[model samples]
Target: MRFLRNALLALAACAFAARPAMAQEILRDTESEALLQDMAAPIVKAAGFQPGAIDIVLLNDPSINAFVAGGQAIYIHSGLIETADNANEVQGVIAHEMGHITGGHVIRSSEGMADASRISILSLLLGAVAVAAGSAEAGMGAIMAGQRAALGKFLAFTRVQESSADAAGAKFLSDAGISGRGSIAFFDKLMGEEIRHGISQDDDEQFVRTHPMTGDRMSRLRDVYSKDPAWNTPVDPQLQSRFVLMKAKLEGYLATPEATLRDYPLSRDDEAALYARAYAYHKDARMDQAIAETDALLSREPDNPYFLELKGQVLLESGRPDEALESLRRANELTRNSPLIAAIFGHALIATEDPAHYDEARQVLRAAVARDRDNPFAWYQLGVVYAAQGDEPRARLASAEQQILSREYARALMSARAAESALPKDTPDWLRAQDIRMQAEAELERSRDRR
Candidate 1:
């Protein structure tokens, strides 16, 4: 246990590698991922981590945080997005996290650690939190986050190791055509936050708790950037516009209607700004205003897939089922793979009573499932679609499976035990298979008791 603890800490601090206990099923959808991919393209090529294959999971936490849990995965907090004022900053964060994976930090840590169990448990805690919060699809599995206070109770890294990660990460930024200035700037922001909070380390995020902060480190980062050619590179227009627009849309989604309109208005310079306003009005429940703004944006841009997507969402939310279907179908045709848009279309299909919806829903869901197979929510929805048209046996199985996947622990345990009867005992993936089975059981039990 001690080995695991010390190792994970050292790895996180020294090499920035993560030997995660279990991988979270969190995944990014096609539309939201487009921008992330655009931003990451430079460094991913430089870093040599299967460029398009690497997954970036967006965590739901509002705190300023980011990390690479698995060797190939990058987890960015939704709060990180809200906090980053520009695309460069977000890219810098990703580059730093990616550095950890490239460095083999976790494996290095494990090689030197003492207590394997303690390390594994601590890692499990962090992994679980990230999985629930950062999952791409709506329903993240299980809930243990209320006990975050207990998350870092095991081996954690030294200040020296953290410093190494930062130094290494800065290099990744430079190699990726981004100025390490973003790292410096981000640390600067956090340092300001620390000062504002009186450097209350006790109140810092879980990631910060393990990876402490210092002003000298920030200064060092700035010095590194002084020599980086990317420091002067201008931020791309498309990236900048998307950042603002995404932030605006997310704000509108979470904040109150008045607040939404206040932050994101229609009379902006870019097409994205217009899309943001359209979304704000949609959420504000002003149908006419939303449609008018969207149509105007369409008139200007003529064929923005994102705008079309927003139009679909607005139409659906505002009770225009048929129109929503048309818009979403068009949006899907344009992009060919958007889970959010597909999900919306599924709902719209129900309203349209179109016979084609049954198969398309399955097809869209299949695509969605391909991207995020562990998404019990998508699976559950698929089960419903199957059940709605009278496939009781398939519906029951999917429901049972989904219920298990969603944390029906006891039931999943039973199901796994049942599966065990016919399984080969020596299979290498046996443990992994059983673990998932147990998680499903746990979810089932919890849901039944509602605790």
Candidate 2:
């Protein structure tokens, strides 16, 4: 379970499967994800981490929360995303998580997790610590779950790490062209709210009880925010859009399409709200409505990557593969190195009538897999494409890899057997996975000769 969950994390939050075909559900929409990319760019560049590998995901629980688990991914609860009013407040949170990763908080702390069937529970426990160490913790139960004595005596140690992250995060913001107030003001907001909300709800953590949010600290932070060198740079425009898109997506997911449509900007002029309602319509399978909404949106923002991607998706679902391809191709061009776009393109190629398009589909999926080795959709699609290409050996290999990603090792063995039948008798990659595959010819020959 740790192995599987960790795989998704390493892949930058592609998904997690609690059941077959229902695997890791992407929590946020493409727009918010793109916004997170914008928020992540400067901090990652400053920290020298791989850009695009670190994404911010919103969990659905309403309790104010944000966390970073699985090394490179940041998880923010939808509650937190909706709770923050402006971009800098959110960037402040991003900076804190960046602090944790930059300071080696994850590697130093997570070296101790053990494997068991209860690995999911353990990973949850350990993952919380890693997230806290990463310099951001919100959501319900984070503080208590992490600081619990049963968990460890680690929070005291983690507090030092947190302080270091706070200092480093401030520096990261200064270097990344954002203000310290993005960081300071965010803490201030939490502190400010806690004063009004006051005291734990039945579900709230006890750790927050002892970790007081003092007026003096907030005042000092405000003073620092005013004098901080980083405040001159405004929040990125893209981040603001993502903020709206995330709220809109979460709102759509939690509520009704009627609610979304009813609230959609009264004007035909509001593209952002229009796009949101289109997604809501798509979710509702009101295909004509969704297509109409997207068409109007595309008319206004022909080059907008998010709108183009949505239009392509609507086209595909509406059974217009040819049109989907054109729109998807444009979307792909607008976003560099996006696995989601590649996967959509792969689907487009495979659906087309051209026989040679299978290879094109394979290549696009391969690119997606290369970008995120853990994206099961890319690996699964590649396996299908390779099989269609009559490259049973490669298809088998892809199948096995996908199985590994999805925790279906038994089926992986089946794929390996079919693949090995078509390949040269031996290869190193095949040999490494030999124990897990069906018995092959050389092994059979060795058994017969020994007998």
Candidate 3:
């Protein structure tokens, strides 16, 4: 889990330095990302996006919501994944969010707001005219009526957009040759939640809500899906299997150990159960039990990089860095040096406290950051390597990298300046340090302007 504040949001935070800004919590896991990417690729392409053009980001929030904030990204809450029965269900949600992107709804939302504002302003004018005529009660009533009307108008616009996205999603699924059964099933789950919460599906409530009634959406989607040729198609078995494991993995990581044990007991020795129990045991600080569970997984699939990564993580966190290195090194190799896993491997190498390992750590950490510069943790580890080697200039440059990502623009600017002064001019390191200094200065200026 990491906190990612957008650069613009970070600047805004700096502008309001008197109050603490809420950071957006992101869950970045290589295994989960790979699965999500594979699941979203076809839907993305079907929605007219190139492969890798659309990103599916997982948020740490436990709310059953998936939305497109802007651009070509879909943010899926952890709760949505937890609630979903299969990958197909998530795919259905992704397709729907893609509809919002393709329709430019986020950009067009200003139109709805403007339309509502016009009604509100006109109503205020009318109310003022009544007030001037000495009818105080009538003026108040007019003002209140205008507010309600504006709200209703805005909500109606949103509802229309929602319905349009639903139709677009259905078409995307059809074009992708994916089954819509999972989509309908997921809607049924949402409908159940609405009933459980006693949320009325009456006409009046529907008029005020931003979305149409859950039941109405399901009904409309069902009709459209039923007529599609892919309606009866089965989900890919491999994808379904991965989803089950992913869900279990999330449960183990997020749930209390007691709850995880209750849900997946020792008696259940399936791969998913083992994966869950491994994490649960690790969280409970039961080293022997954690290792045993991990060993069970390794026995089943020795070459599995994710399992190896997990084993390495457990070992490293338990202060057995030496024992962790072999597993982590192999995992990194297996994944072709995946940035996230390699970062861990680099950290483990540093944890060994062996000066002999510092060179290898430096190499690994450099490569990790090269592949994924957004990873502050990797940059931190790389800084550790540079500092350990007595390379002050490079160390400051690394610190600048980590600080910039962490939104510490002031500190980053200082570090970058120090690094640029010490490093030889025209060198790559010197150039990167200069870049950071300029970037930090620009962000600081933006923050000042906002203030």
Candidate 4:
């Protein structure tokens, strides 16, 4: 389990950060990602941005943080979702982040340089903290102690940007027909925490450090929202229900088994509780109990793709690859061929270790990788299929693709070079091999320079 966790952490690094040294670990959960999209899409459109213009990135960090970096992308911490009571609170945050993007705050800042690697989460957070501290010097002092006042001014510019974002975000929420109450309440709660922590002078929490809490900002939010009719509107009950279910699933996977069980005892007996308990049991390696709980979920919503996906995932991990196929296949069908499910299904096929399944595994995995090019696991499985078929060059190319996605540049370089030498010259595969070789070499050079 630890090995799997570590490998997942390694693969979590996103391809968006193409710079070899600037990889950001991302969590890829279809349900969570889909929910985030659903919440953000309307607010994003309301903010006068094209739907395809912005991208949402989920981080596995437990910290309650979210920021915009790399221009259009929003990086949200898992802790934010787990801690928020409802979807509106998170949607509110997304709306604000979108404001940053829409207000041109992200692109206008020095952090949002033309180079993707320069647009970092660290810079965004530091800018926010600087704004909160209300001192250009204090903000720069934390990182660059001896810089001139100009650098301080540069960092301090974030205050105006933050204020603009707050106003813009409020308008977006109203326009989207969502109550800004969630945004206001969220800030109110954060301010309360800041006060409690300030009383002791032990320093502020990470959130407080990054997002400066001010009475004026809070008042502005309240004033703007109070005037809007949507301020009194309640969140959609259906959205609220989905939010609860998503939170329970996250808690189950992220929290300890005991903690999950304690929070979601059998007597609770709700679908969300059952889902949480199922994950807890899976983590504890109680296969029968886990499957039984999953069955309970499936029995309630027989055609639900997520429940089927979970059951298939557990079965696959528990060494019942054949049994995993049915559920995963059904899930793939129901979900309109989700790349994640397809990838997992391909993995099950490969797990059987039968040469007869290799051809089908290769086809399925190829389709999965085609859909999600950043999926290193799918690429790895495709390489396995290729190797099983005695196609060394294709295997090496796929292996190189996997290593590149995993940010193992040295290994990728070697594999790409091997593929390059063995494949037909000037062909698509050879050209791809050349591209990998160049990227990997450049990455390796950067690493050496860092040393």
Alpha-carbon lDDT of model 1: 0.65
| Clash total of candidate 3 | 0
Error (Å) of candidate 2 at residue 311 is 1.2
Best-matching candidate per lDDT: 3
* Models ranked on lDDT: 3, 4, 2, 1
**Whole-model Cα lDDT per candidate?**
0.65, 0.65, 0.87, 0.78
Worst 10 residues of 4 by lDDT: 12-21
Candidate 4 lDDT by residue in tens digits, 1-451: 2332232223222111112223546878787778788888889899887875677778777766677764778888788888788888988888888787777664565442222222233454575598687977666554343222223333335555677788888889989999988887777666666577773323242222223345557887898899999988998787888889989999899899999999999899899999999999999999999999999999999998999999999999999998898898898788776788888988988898877777888888888888888889888989988988899998999999999988899999999999999999999999999999999999999999999
Candidate 4 structure lDDT = 0.78
lDDT of each residue in 1-451, candidate 3, tens digit only: 0111132233222211112112457889999999999998888889888988987888877768877665677788899999999888998998888888899887777677677777777888899999999998898898878877877777778888889999999999999999999999999988888888988878668885778888889999999999999999999899998899999899989999999999999889999999999999999999889999999999999999999999999999999999999999999999999999999999999999999999999999999998899999999999998999999999999999999999999999999999999999999999999999999999999999999
- Candidate 2 vs candidate 3: the TM-score winner is 3
By summed lDDT, the worst window of 10 consecutive residues in model 1 runs over: 138-147
Measured against the true structure, the TM-scores of the candidates, in listed sequence, are: 0.72, 0.71, 0.93, 0.83
lDDT of 1 by residue, 1-451 (tens): 3444443455444333232423433433455678888788777887776568667776555667777655577877677788888888888788777666776655555443434344455555655666667762322222232122223332244344566667777877787777776677787887777778876544344353455555666777788888888888877788888777778666655566776666555456465556666766777688888888889878886677777877877888777888887778888778776666666666677656666678777677667656656667666776677767775544554554565656565655654554444445646334534665666755666677996
Winner by TM-score: 3
Candidate 2, overall lDDT?
A: 0.65
Task: Name the better of 1 and 4 by TM-score.
Answer: 4
TM-score of model 4 (CA atoms): 0.83
Query: Can you list the residue pairs that collide in candidate 2?
Result: 15-24, 16-24, 17-23, 17-24, 64-139, 65-138, 65-139, 100-134, 179-230, 179-231
